[model samples]
Target: MQRIIVIAASAGSLDPLKQIVSALPVPCSASVFIVLHVGPNQAVLPALLGVLTDLAVVHAEDDTPIEQGHVYVAPPGWHMRLETGRIRLDQGPKVNHVRPAADPLFISAAETYRERVVGIVLSGYGDDGTDGLLAIHESGGLALVQDLDEAKVPGMPYAALYGDHPDAFLTAEKIGERVAALCG
Candidate 1:
């Protein structure tokens, strides 16, 4: 089965994400899903990420096909969930005070994909993605997190690293390289 990568981040995440995305090989075997905390009115993340990487990045829409080699970013103020090979955007209650929280996306993918999911936590101000990472780990999926020293804001990565379940601990660039190798 192809990989399903769900990444969650918040404050001070853009640069790390750019490196990670730019390093991922073109024609990857994973369909990447990203959640970033942005206000309801801000919608430029996908385009910004698009300019930094070779992958085709788009704001996820309801019922959209989750195709390999493409990057789908949750729209501001909505959560994106994986439903088999498709995506469903939900206006569900926010987690950790953020609508597009990583927990929902990570848990959805972990539940549906089981061992095929890769849950990643990056730079952020809080512990939003930690529970999601736990779900992936409990389901036998790989949980990867950035090293705290490498993160602009270390709270999210630190939370994941504070636990024993994360499969690997590395820098953002290294994580991207490792992901490319896994999905190649």
Candidate 2:
């Protein structure tokens, strides 16, 4: 069980990510933060996803307080970080050639929340979240990866499995169920 959940995905990941979010059970006490690959002008994601999930979905803003049962999507061009119950967005240099890399977000959340964090890596083209998931593991947090066969782009999950070796491999819906179970 964890108080914070961070999800990272890219390249053919939108559908799975959306499913994961929409399937998340209620009484969800943990706050969800997402890092998805998008262009600088890609601002419609939060709204688009909001329609699919019961939880409030909004684009993340700098220095915004983190809340339970809400999903925060990292805005384009900024790296999002978790800071003691709040969020901080910065224009940091890109990692893995992506501006809003998952490593920074996962690492920051793990560093701040320690064992009270869960980091999940989903479908994506390249290896972006491996280091971050490793950081989460080192911090005693839960690390999960989507099943390689199920992912639209298996590269990211495979990398996480081989490079970081997460605690579980699951489908998006199963992952959501697991998250809900953690609250029990």
Among these predicted structures, which one has the highest TM-score?
Answer: 1
Q: Tell me the lDDT of candidate 2.
A: 0.88
Give the per-residue lDDT of model 1 (tens digit) for 1-184: 8999889978888887888888888788889999998868889888888987678999999998889999999999899888988899989898988999999999899999999999899999888889889999999999999888888899999888775469988898888898888778
* Backbone clash count, each prediction separately: 0, 0
- Which stretches of candidate 2 lie above 4 Å from their native place? none
Q: Write the per-residue lDDT of candidate 2 for residues 16-35, one digit (tens) a residue.
A: 88777877766678898999
* Range of the 10 consecutive residues with the lowest summed lDDT in candidate 2: 175-184
lDDT of each: 0.88, 0.88
In model 1, which runs have C-alpha deviations exceeding 4 angstroms? none
Return the clash pairs for model 2, or none. none
TM-score, every prediction: 0.96, 0.95
Lowest-lDDT window of 10 residues in candidate 1? 156-165
